[model samples]
Target: MKAATFFDGIGWREGVVELVDGGARLRDEVPATGIPRLDGVVVGGFTDHHVHLQLVDHSQLACSRLGRVVDLGGDPDVVQRLAVHPVRIEFAGAFLAAPGGYPSDRAWAPDGSVREIADADAAAAAVTEMAEAGASCIKVTSNSVAGPVFTDELLRTVVELAADRGLLVVAHAEGAGESERVIRLGAARLAHAPFTERLDDDQIARQSASASWISTLAIHDDPARAVAIDNVRRFHTAGGTVLYGTDLGNGPMPVDLSPREIAALREAGLDDAALLRALSPVDPLDPDSNLLLLPGSSPAAADPLAARPLTPADLKV
Candidate 1:
């Protein structure tokens, strides 16, 4: 099970991944195996930290070897079942929003997936419900361009409630200064790559210091592609943590590793080291699954859509 390239710390470390009947291991190269042959790295076993798993067709995603998924925004019960199911899923259940805010009217978002809370008590209750339902984190929607946005106060309540419940809060931040607003309040992750607003050096530094961002650049649509790329570029330059996310069910994105999205991240200055961390599955609930095996050579800096397969390599003990 020798892999030509695999994620190690900041960059790819070439190595051999050995798998036994019950466990796995990785070393310098292919070691003598009692078994006659080795499987190539598992394609698609990587974690997608931000995805609308409930909205996606499982078959398409299952086609690739996706080992686990982190549903960024969806119903808690649904996410809970997903977590318990065989797929090895993690989730940030529901979009905590102001009453009647964005996605409340979106055709794609269902009622269960949108939990609207007007004050701290209701926010706390909703937060508890999601936590009890076994959610790994909370997701907030602050997409001002789509509809009414949450007031600073209500957003704070959601953050506070999430903290009380020991869950991280991830936000769909958009429009002017929205990214700053969330980062300032201790949001742990951004569901979408920033697009509508340009962040300054200070702001990028602040976000880098505070939160991780999921890159859904391909869904930005061509008109706003450059803006998304530039936002990610600056964020990466500032040493911000960026996660690879496809927002899978949002549009016509590939159900698996999106080459275009990878290219977009590379264009935005995410070098090989940064790129590997962004794609690795290291979510809290999923403390195992030591490695993500992307078979084949990494894409050249120029071509972004170079990722081919994900292999299930040996787990670190």
Candidate 2:
């Protein structure tokens, strides 16, 4: 089928994409299937890097434009079951926190979703349980504002254990000193961009060099929102990897691609190319499985997020 125009995450071009078994490839020529001409640009499907499947209606998410999602924290058994759904999912089985830590007492957390480590000695075992349960990464909490947090030693142990298993560690770091601890402990990613406080330049550079920050910028409001936007902007300027992740299911937010979240990322200083890269999946995540065909000419290069997402079935010749 011919797409009048298309943007393959790099630039705009006109081409006929041959869809094969849920994947697509650009071709020079092909026999017309008598399918009506497609107008507008086609691009890769997007991924929401942070979400809680246990809290949202999974069916609604499956029907949305999102091609894949990374479940940050959820009940292991429930997450495992949902992983088999049509919308691809990469998940961290549960939230590993210090005993009585954040989310343990929260009304939203499901049973068996938050495992509190009793001591540093149990760090390895706890991480192993998550990996064995098919978790893509280990998620740990370092939210000092909520309650008790993992000591440096315990946090270090958890990171090491995850590393040993060839998995990365994503941390929910909030409150004072939490970001510093996450950096010092060598976590590979921050579940949310640093909020609650403005980070100094050196701290921002250090964190940027060490870990990628998921842009949950739309989740914050007003003063705190400005702080996060500044931190992310500096981090991006310092050559940090900014990933697009809306904390879906955490509050009243869109189950699919959030235009507000995209706008926030742009406000955080990400250009069109950077925004595309953030939304595109990396190796093993499979962004090619589905295509986002946007009607009309490509959206302003700087605001590609304004385009809607369309599935392969919607564009199949």
Q: Which candidate's TM-score is highest?
A: 2
Residue 4 alpha-carbon offset, candidate 2, angstroms? 7.0
In the range 197-258, model 2's lDDT, one tens digit per residue, is 99999998898888999999999988989999999999999999999999898788878789
Q: What stretches of model 2 exceed 4 Å from their correct place?
A: 3-15, 19-38, 83-85, 281-288, 299-306, 309-317
lDDT to native, each model: 0.69, 0.79
lDDT of 1 by residue, 53-144 (tens): 77877556545434567887787776676533224677878888878888888899855898877878888888888888888888888877
Clash list (residue pairs), candidate 2: none
Candidate 2 residue 224 C-alpha distance from true site, Å: 0.9
What would the TM-score be for candidate 2 when compared with the true structure? 0.87
Task: Give candidate 2's error at residue 311 in angstroms.
Answer: 6.5
Q: How do all models score by TM-score?
A: 0.81, 0.87
Best by lDDT: 2
Q: How close to the true structure is residue 305 of candidate 2, measured as C-alpha lDDT?
A: 49
